[model samples]
Target: MEPDKLPLVQCSLALLAERLTPRDRVSIVGYAGNAGLVLEPTYDKEKVVAALARLEADGSTAGGQGIELAYRFAERNRMEGGINRIFLATDGDFNVGVTDIRALIGMVERERDTGITLTTLGFGSGNYNDAMMEQIADHANGNHAYIDNPREAQKVLEEELSSTLFTSPRT
Candidate 1:
């Protein structure tokens, strides 16, 4: 049997879209094998939730595609003069395909130099890969946290909204 689609991840993404600035660019990175999965365009909460419902656990290669999509978005937005981040919402279990933790971390690290940060919101429990999620966030110069409930998602989004949106701290 396959795992269920995480509602918390969907809610968090929805909340994020609500808080994004007009200058901010939003992109989603979800599993490729999930046929009905579609990342809604920025600010489209209903579409995002609809897309999340169709998501399914595929393979580790899906994670790689997520990373690639994020990097490509960052590259394109390099000249936009605003915050750039890849908000990855996953269970963190990289299996059924190419599962090189190091390679994933390296890719995130390389992109960080270009001012692209990675924030991971982990979902589920049993199959969660805490180390990979945390390491990717750290190497990408960003942050990671698990959201098992809706309230936690709100806290993370409301409290860290500034940290997540603003690229630099005001001195």
Candidate 2:
């Protein structure tokens, strides 16, 4: 991963924080070799942004583990009638744990059935698995966005935050 992409992600998340309300809970889970919770569920946007800024992409990407951990946090802090979504920001190159596409899709489908949708934020360009990212979002009743620059980030994380994060029930 290019070192600069991390800053873009950080800035994007900061922009997202500005849109969140006190009732919303935010948790960050990042994975390389293994997934770890960077921030616990909190309404404190500052803490969320700080955690994002501290993130330094390294090691092999355990994309599946990262999604699983994120779901756990989201489920734990889930609101009864509000949105419970996972924004998976990745290059979509799952070289490490749970690398199989079908298995990953199955996992996402199960989560979606339980009302936890996934939105894939594709970061970087080369070697980025656009197909996988789009498929994951499609199967999970979510959306996919490629964020390669600050303007695109603003468009996705700020301009379209409501529609991106809050979707109507699919009948």
Candidate 3:
């Protein structure tokens, strides 16, 4: 990933952070060669911002591990009536670990019953697989957005934050 895009990601995160309240919780999970929790679920926006700042986009995408770890965190910290989502910001490449699309869909489908939705943010060019991102979101009963620049990031992560985060109860 280009170093310049880091600022755009940080900017988007800041915008999202601005909208957060004490009732909101954030967890940051990053994957490169492997997946790890950057920040545990917490109400502190500053902590979330700090975690995002420390991120560097390098190495192959280990999306499967990342998704599994993210789901684990979401399940553990689930809010009874509040939003439970995993915002997967990626270039849509899963080069390492469970790269098969069918496998990915199955994994996401299994988590659907947990009431944890996925929102895929497509970043980067050339390697950005919009189809894969859309499929992942669809399987998880969520949404997908293609964001190549700061403006698009703002539109999805800031201007439409509420719509992306809030969902009507599944009846």
Candidate 4:
């Protein structure tokens, strides 16, 4: 959650954005405290950063709300032009809210039908929640990665843009 680490995440998102054919929608579900804020698909960097910072300061940091928000956002996006994905960037801490891992995974699995993949980016180390991150991404038909540094983030954004952009068909 350092200032320096943000650019890496943002850069990754930006890289992913470029590959989007102007028709693709990228929604962000960011959680900080007990609240989950859904950001509409947009390529505006400053607005995205401000939204993320506000959520970071709000403080509940619940992953379940974040997931819920993403699912709902995807549903809404689907009505428009179908959803590309819901990207969750966090340290993987799911406290102060729904803490049941199995239940959360179940919810994500159900949402996968909406055609929105879930990609999780784990940041920081001391309080990271690897199990939860892996479960959500896996169940949602997406991949999870740990971003320990800015460089790694850029590499992921620049390199894995395709895999991250394409959603798996519901099985």
Tell me the spans in candidate 3 whose CA falls farther than 4 Å from its real position: 1-5, 166-171
State the weakest 10-residue window (summed lDDT) of model 3. 162-171
lDDT of 4: 0.69
Candidate 4 lDDT trough over 10 residues, lowest sum? 51-60
Question: Which lDDT values do the candidates have, in the order given?
Answer: 0.67, 0.83, 0.83, 0.69
**lDDT of each residue in 31-133, candidate 4, tens digit only:** 6675454567665655555555444434357778777877776776674455457778775478867888898889888887766778888876666788889
- List residue ranges in candidate 1 displaced over 4 A: 1-5, 32-37, 44-50, 58-61, 164-171
Better of 1 and 3 by lDDT: 3
lDDT per residue for candidate 2 within 80-135, as digits (tens), equals 99888889988548888898899998888888877888889987767789899888
Clash counts for all predictions: 0, 0, 0, 5
Question: Residue by residue across 43-83, what tens digits does model 1's lDDT show?
Answer: 45555556656655554436766677667866775645666
lDDT of candidate 3 over 1-171, digit per residue (tens)? 473355566667777777779998999999978999999888788888888889877758999999999999999999999889998988648899989999999999899889999998877677777899899998897888877777888888877766667644333
As for candidate 3, its clashing pairs are: none
Greater TM-score among 2 and 3 belongs to 2
Estimated TM-score for each candidate: 0.79, 0.92, 0.91, 0.79
lDDT of 1 at 23: 56
TM-score of candidate 1 relative to the true fold: 0.79
lDDT of 1: 0.67
Candidate 4: C-alpha RMSD after superposition: 3.0
Residue 66 deviation, candidate 2, in Å?
A: 0.6
